[model samples]
Target chain A: MNPPNIIFIVFDTLRRDICSIYGGDVKTPNIEEFLKDSNIFPRAVSSSPWTVPSHMSFFTGLYAREHGVHEDLEHGDGRVLDKIYEYNGDNIISYLKQKGYLTIGYSTNPWLSPGTGFDRNFSSFTFFSSEYMNLEEMNAVNEYKRYGKNRYEAAKNLILSGNFQEFLKYYRIHKRIIKRKREVGYPFIKGSDLIFDHIMNSSYEEPFFIFINLMESHEPSALWELDIDDRKIKYLDLSGREIISEKKMERTRNGYKRSLEILDFQFGRLIKYLKKMKLYDNTMIIVTSDHGQALKEKRKIPYYGHGNFLYDEIIEVPLIIKFNNNVKINIKNWNQSLVNIPEQIKNSIEGSMDDYMTSEYVFSESFGPVHDFETLIKEGILPSDINFSLMNEKMFYPKKAVYWKNYKLVLNGLTGELDEFTENGKSQDPNEKKEIVENLKEQIYIFKGQESFRV
Target chain B: MTQEIRIEGGLSLNAKVAIAKIVINDAIDRFKRPFVVWSAGKDSMVVLHLVRNVAEERHMDMLPALFIDHGQHYEETIEMLDKISKEWNFKVIYARNEDALSAVKGNKIYLKDLNKENQEEAKKIAQPGEILKDENGEYFEYSLETSVGNHILKTIAMNNAIKRYRIDALFTGIRWDENPARSWEVFISPRENPPHVRVHPILPFTERNIWEYTFKNNLPIHPLYYQGYRSIDGKYDSKKTSDKPAWEQDLEHTKERAGRSQDKEGMMEKLRRFGYM
Candidate 1:
């Protein structure tokens, strides 16, 4: 009868195909067990296949156009919070806080910080801190705590250094390396560990909203820790020569599976902890992922990245909700979106059918890391590796895709090609399926989010 | 030939300069020799200076600007115009009612038609609050049809000048806030049917913009402006009559053209309709 305590969990980069609950080959018994009384969504796609912009949509109920937080690889300049303030005014966290929920955030994502306006309205917010958990990097820990200010101050320093362009160029050149090094100090804490700590230590009031992003199941090669990866994550010039032997590939696959099992175990622990506190009966659980992993499957080149692509392996992920208190609402076996979960939860709280949202289509976009084509070409990257014509037409071709029923149309803004796909990511013959293709293209063109952005 | 120049506009001093240059360039291209109606006021002076600058920049012929000598201007105003004309080397058409010009030039044959005694009486300058009386303190009924009214004579001289120069276009520094009739005017407007066009380069500029641009560019404004005579015209506009003059009045509180007697008679609308700047 009372307001339910909501638990929103994001198993970062957890593929729907790999999760047993979504009928994947991998064993995720914990998620499968959680699905018994939960409403399950098999094909829930993210607004973006990455954390920052995707989470922006989740918080504000707006697409990238409305939030204006798409990745700007060209500038690589300011924080997402500065860009987001102009567009995102109404926040779901603030709404739920007004509704008398003791909101708390337990996230490992830097994108989910106060810098990005994500930590507002939360009574207590804890991060899976790199220094606090690892205890080896004290200075990095301080920088972690002062993330926004530090980044801002560093940017100011760069500008005041009187060589801002050089600084930007250097940052752009070494950004991926710096990022990889920075991830060494990233909060790589396991979800189960966080849940255990919360259960054992912190005591909050009833009807609390806990938002969690667990990063144990993030990348296949670097599944063990953010520090251990030696191989470069190739995307633009994945010339197939970067392929590891079958034995090494099997080891990487096993490492990903091991991390998945750990995530599942941790999920089970979270559920068990809730039951132990006599809170399982009253808690509402919404399960999904920020994105899915890409393990160089069904492609010409060996690519091991997610954010740069819009394939089902990158965007399509699971959505599960155990709303035991709100028994009147149950959606099953229909194509929906991970984006609608925030609004749906708000509607379920307000007990309104008129304002409740339902969507027959879901959309996704890929803002970029900005591949330097000149460097790619000079490095003797074959045209087969990445079609040069796509880059030739536009310096960067950010992709926008819309999924309706079984059909999906991916429009590459740079190349100006609208590639359509049918079920299981199979390329569709557009001439044969003329009506749906044309109707879907028109609908995409006229969509409210694409009004100003003709590309 | 008129030199071609790029036209870009913004709410800045540089943009106004660019727009002024474009207006002058466009006038040259659009007409045989376009005529600009110069009033020796701040707006007119700044725009005229801009035309001179553009001419110097492009190494093109200067604007064929015409100053309508209404025969009632102060000697000081005439001195300032002569000085500027000598500096800029622009073609100066001292357009008048022809009879007025003849009288000034002492051409007795043309001046014989004038009534000498009434002309001397009409020419006698009087101080403010002394000569004018209509029960209303301010002159407000606007008309331009009278033979003696300067509006008709100015329009006649302007039309003759347009015909003499074979000008297909005329550029005017008539700002939007001057009157209700000029408020809705666009940047480029065609008048007197086809071919004869009116180009308003600074139509979007406000009074504040004009002042700000003058100060920003260090453009020389008329000397009377500093003496609190904001709207400086030849005959009726002095610090004595209309009190401190319309220019001295708070631009926000009072209309800029309020000091001019002919505007009160609604003659400005008729003059504009007759293609008078």
Candidate 2:
């Protein structure tokens, strides 16, 4: 029997609701077409809403609690591996390699780079140059001055310069401030093409396991082409005043949609290429995103975006897997988290068709100092300068509903209150809030009670 | 009767001047064939400035800078190194443990691998005068390759082309206060197998002294330090603040503890779980 070739594609900041297969208005014809033949998990959720931890969970098959690589570490104890239980007694790449598979990974997110330990399980991994982003790079000393003078100015200068090298310098100066935006405009498909070509033409005699990450929807959404008809219109409200000019909004949304379409198109082409090469039949292709994006939609918080909160829009993502002809299981009703992926892969490999369910409740946390109320104020996310001394203080609030067999419970982190919202002019009552608080508190206590996974 | 003189402050003007003169003299003495270890960090920047100053003062030929690229350094570090190299017109050479880094890149090696490999190799590469075997035929040697003959040979081969052309002495800017391990390093030491001598011109200096000197001398340091980072260890910290005490904000000690030998097994376990091992 031929070893399965695996293809893992991650779309950065891609919201599940926007995809056509996920019941959105987005014109993802290629994706919709592909999903028809593939196994799509409509209720797939992410371990974390943010990129780093989410990707960690996906690859390691452990919740953030088990791994402990929660936020960026300036000088991490470098003991990240000790916290992880050898899901299969080895990493995914090592396991696959032992099975005679050639591993390759390409990501536009720098966090996925080897510096952050994400490159560990892959034979080859490449990250988009952070130099392309218009941000000040933080040096060791500047990292000392977390929120220093001219921080934004330095970042803006780098952006304005448009020179990759200069941008790298600025990026070092203000890494904390510009990390997200710097991740926004990566050319995902183009970068992956380089790896794909190498894999196709290389003389290496091994089945391939390829991973690709696309960063189009991250931030400063800059992928739309101005020529599309859907993006060319201009609009005005009933007052004849422009809430958002039709042409501009169309241009922005169209650009983002066009990029998604391009991703889908490329994915289809890659699959076809693999099929033509006779590698598709044995390949188990899985499509997933680290996390979903916030498209300026109203959530518990009146605003739309990831970070500071883990709402459905941020935590829920699209997961699709196509496993040649061995199995025909449609896991439509099964809600799973990214952490369940590795075990699922193992079970699938062993030909286990039993109803394998993910844990009922998964947890995540972010401890970066930038999440303080002051930074939010600077970013204009909050109403005023709120005392953020309580930001570091962990507060747990239970979710309104635990989806997928009551196994999965959502707990609100630091910004839980800000995300509280009213639906149709009616706010949730004290009882609803109390239930959420209780569930969240229980999860927190459970996390605290567990022996520190520190080796 | 002669009046006894009393200095108004902790250090007298003469004492300060004498100390400055001694520092300048030591810098000049070391600059003759200085091989500056340029990490593009704060201390290295000061070292480079001191070397340049010494060269200018004595009208001696400047030495080339040496950079050991671990391949995972921040982009800013590379850029600053390039800029400083070009601005100062100093020859720059970057040496990398490609095998180790590639192993790291391929997930075959990790931070623990470094310590493990170093420990194993340490037992095999004993110094010339040191006892390498016991009477019962048990073999023993130095605990680190940093002082090994083969490592010295490799370093010479890797660095000789540039160092032979210019350097006679390797000038390192390591300060005693950076880490407990560095506290015992002497001001000067002879190379194990090479002809060149190792000099720590800034051995007596504290972190504050280095900062004061760099500030007074207007040296170009890697800008990350100004942002809030206190160490050269490649890690990310998002909450560093300039106004706060470094110890209060910096995670260097915590991070260092993660890599210590006392926690070796634990660190290895963490590395394994993260798939780094």
Candidate 3:
């Protein structure tokens, strides 16, 4: 048989427990239906707590420490393309492209845009900004950037070039987008309607690789075209600068549920379209997340975002894969790391199913706050008086979590302290399993190439 | 400190600078807590300058410089460090092994008087009979030539700083063209004992490239490099190679680190394995 077409879908910032299939209250009907023939990995761990590193791990099959494309105190987002370019010839995209696959990419996340080197070997890559999905807004953003973010300069240049009509058109679209946002939170982000419409309109050859990153379940909750603006939920609720009222949080949670409902509807539509096109059975669809988000759940500290901590609510993501061929494949209920996504794809291409998503040891790493929070404070985006000392102590440390069997250990590299040692997700004394702890610690050292100093 | 061959010689200085900036930017992005291992030497100065450029572009303050204060550095070196760091607005954190420094008596360091931690480290890296005796019992010469001395004074100090500061990445100035041991190293290398990654941003640069970058960027030059010494280390172990200035000397055929004789006869590989740069 020929190689099957691959469709890797990333549900950005999606938590496993929130899904209905994972025994949560949120209704993900489409995903539950997809799970009938697919393998659902309930214990899959992301390699990093944020976007760039975790996605790089998926593409390179290496941890953040090994790949070295993560965030630090000095850098949060830009200039990462230079580092990503180093893996151009060795990444999964290039590998599959070399194997005669028509590689295409669609990322709604700004970090995975073409400017960031995420489109290295793709035949065509398109970045659909959540706010700039309309052609007019995209043209306006491009023009603003062309003039170095100077609106007046962009207008002057456009008018000078005899493109005054185009300038007016861009202005009208920009105003419409902003007005829509002000009137009803965010528009068209949750359903991914634009992306799905694009996909339905485009035709593809056989044995192709399509990578899609949807930001529906991400932030703003898209507020359901609700008048309630959940945009400040990220800055105010996440940073704990202003505690969200219980009623407001309940409304936010409901908005999130509605967002999921919208996403599920879109997903169902995609599935139906694929089957209508007679392509559902021939496509290998893999759905996973780079990392999960924290909604201010009970914890040692008030955590609200994904990148600062390695809590289960942030690192544990869903890994569901529907392979093309139907075979009685044994699903090992072992820990799986997102770093093995590349190997799983390769195995699928080679017609292998055994041990495809199984691993004895899974690891996840975090390097402090992925965003430049200090700069935010300096720029008054965050309150300067808010004390970051305690938060920094908790969030700024380099942490690594190792999952072996039913035990998990999260070690803090800064203090050489065990931030967490649990069995089956409950706190446990590490001394009772000293051997396992030592072995896992040695595994970390070896993975970091520091085994020579393991005592 | 000595280089035998110039293997990666074809890249233009601009290309080398671009690659080094990429490496530096990646390290700044990947590691939570990072420091530049600045020794106030030419190669390290280039590394510091490159890191500063990236940090400035990113609107980040310069990473603190970890100066391995072995208590044997040149006065001019210290003066240059003080002046330049003040002018450039970066912190210089001295990584000194206080236990070993305080135990020094004239030219000999009493090994028995060191703390138990320092003694254990010295015992692990020291060769048999290398620890001699003076009027005090079981002492080693306060010299950087011995593997044991270098380990106790510099490596131990640096490692302690790493543990103390919880440094996850250290930007060092080791180049591929510097020595055979470092020739195999990549842009980012992980180290043990204290467990941190070494970010070698200038690994592809040769001695000539270092000078060219220094001159083109107008980086601060060590006074001794102008006085015919190609490589400057602790004043006790360094010497002048020729009467001519460093750049005027025969760079292609002559040894770049001829003045620094600590890395002699396969000693650098051993020192490097024991956490010496």
Candidate 4:
């Protein structure tokens, strides 16, 4: 028998408990139907709380420490391209390509774009902008941010700057975006529909690998003015510059829920098309997330976004796997790390289905703040009084977690101390369960190879 | 090759000592009726001295030390245990499995005459051809060299001691660099079956760190270690790896447990899973 074709989907920033399949409130009816023939891993953890490191783990089956594609104190992605070029030859994409599988990738995340090494071995890779960012929309947002408050002044400033054609075009795009926001109750961010549309239109060879990343459930949640920038929000959230209002959090969270509903409808369309194309039975489909988003969840520190925190809201993600031919497999209640995806795919290709994805120990990692706060301050996105040095020192500690059965141990790399020890999501005193903490800490040390651990 | 535990990689002798003391204080604060597992070796002697310092700080009497007497200990080990406990003004509890020891006849122990616990332990751990049967009953050799003998004689004996005294925690001097199975151990670990915790205050200490602490504190050195044996275990099975003292030998390139029984060391993971320290 031929090897199964693979369809890997990542719902960027999708939380597990929020989905109905994992016993959450959000009604993912399409996901519920998919679960009938799928295995749902309730305790799947992403390797990092943000995009670059988590996606690298998915592609390479190694932790962020191993790949060295992670964020540090002052820079977010300065060395991404260099690291990817250096290590891309040994990843799952190259492995599958060598195995005679035609690999293709589609992503709406800007970080996973073509030049960033995320598209290395793909036969074809495309980055779909979440929102329609034609040259006109870019000018409109830039012009709006430049001009203070009045629309006429912005138009006057643009025309005075010898950009009259650009001014008229920007005005038209600005009006259209506002009208679209009024109609849809949210700003235009590309959803799963764009990827599904492309998939339906394209023709592929047998035994192909399809990778897709959908960004509908990400931030910029509620309806926004065309001038409201994501970088401003990102800076404020990650730097803890401002205490977000509860009302704003509720609005953003509700918008996120609505986005999930839209995503479910779009995903339902893909399942229908796969069945119509007669590829449903022979295709191996996996739907998971890179990481989960935090909606001002109350933690040791209130978490509003991903990247810096190791809280449960940020690391726990949803995992749904539908093996080819709808194989009946036992799903053990073990913590499954996303780093094992590559090996799981290899085992499936070799027709080894006996406890193929079982993991005795799973891990997640985060190295300080993912954004360059200094740049944000210089760009006027944040206030100069943000205490940049203090924030960097406080948030720059490399945090890692090790999960075994029901217990989790979060260790701080800087002080060599236990940050938090929890069982089944409730914090326990480390003094009480020192054995479990030590065991999990040992796993974390081993997972992070000794060379990285020393540094 | 086995991966090295890098927790103690860049730490200085003073920093490692501070961390070990913190672990010891945490064990004292959490567990009542805690006891130190002393083998009269260099590592445990350092732990005992650290515990004495902490006790002096808190103005409370130090806890007793647990010496596992499996009938295979050297006379020097027993003498050190006696002299050190008296000099340090602490008690020493002898944890001996007398039934298993008394069943030894010639080189073999008759399994039928052993206690139910020893018989069950022998049945589980004794390899094929090791347990022989006569017309009377089954029998296995009385030795501490094999995994079965260690589990029955050492682990089972230690577990019975825990049950007898209701020790909430047992502090030991097992270092991460000591054995492959012990590399992943934490400062305080909970074990089951007999229901107690294993407090490893010096897990992050290396061989060199152990010696540095020994000399800095001017603690008593195990006679066998000074006589060239790096690791002093059962008298019959352990041999000297070199003619020089342990600290004088090549510590980094050589394995520390080279003198211990290979049969027991090879199956350390299995032995540990069954509650052996």
- Most accurate candidate by DockQ: 4
Error of 4 at B247 (Å): 15
Q: Check candidate 4 and list the clashing pairs.
A: A130-A190, A435-B189
- Give per-residue CA lDDT, model 4, range A1-455, as digits (tens): 98899999998988887888888898989989988888887799998999988999999877787677888754765555677677643788899999999999999888887888798899989998766567667666766756533456668888888878867776888788767655644443564777889999988998999999998878777764235556566556555766567887788888888878888888899999999999998999999999998887767666666787788888999998888998867777688889889978988888866444546677788877777766666656667787666565557778888888998888878877877788999989888887877767755654543223321
The count of residue-pair clashes in candidate 2 stands at 58
User: Please, what is the whole-model Cα lDDT of each candidate in the order they appear?
Assistant: 0.61, 0.52, 0.79, 0.80
Off by over 4 Å in 2: A72-90, A130-204, A223-254, A330-332, A353-455, B1-277
Q: What is the TM-score of chain A, computed separately for every candidate?
A: 0.78, 0.67, 0.85, 0.90
Residue-wise lDDT of candidate 2 within A1-455, one digit each (tens)?
65566778898777687788887777776677666667777577777666766777777665554455553222222233333322232456677777777788878676677656667767778776433433334243254233333345445655676656755654554554334434533332334444455556754454677787866665434433212211111111111222344464455555556567767766777776776877766777788888775554443332233543455676678888877553558463446667777767666555664334344444444333213334434533343533323322322222222343333344333233323322222344535566654544444433422221110
Which candidate order results from sorting by TM-score in descending order? 4, 3, 1, 2
Range of the 10 consecutive residues with the lowest summed lDDT in candidate 2 chain A:
A230-239
DockQ of each: 0.01, 0.01, 0.02, 0.03
2 or 4, which is superior by lDDT? 4
Query: Which of candidates 1 and 4 reaches a greater DockQ?
Result: 4
Judged by TM-score, which candidate is best?
Answer: 4
Model 3, span A1-455: residue lDDT tens: 88889989998888888888878898787888888878888689999998888989988877876677887655554435667776543788888988999999998888888878877778999988776447656666666646423455567778888887878876777678778666533543543776788999999998899998988767665343243233334555554667767665666567666666777787888888988998898889989999988776777775655786888889989888888964436778769888889888998889877555667778888766676666555433455676566556767677788888888888887776788888888888888889988877755543443211111
- RMSD of every candidate to native, in Å, equals 23.1, 23.0, 15.5, 12.0
Docking class for model 3 is: incorrect
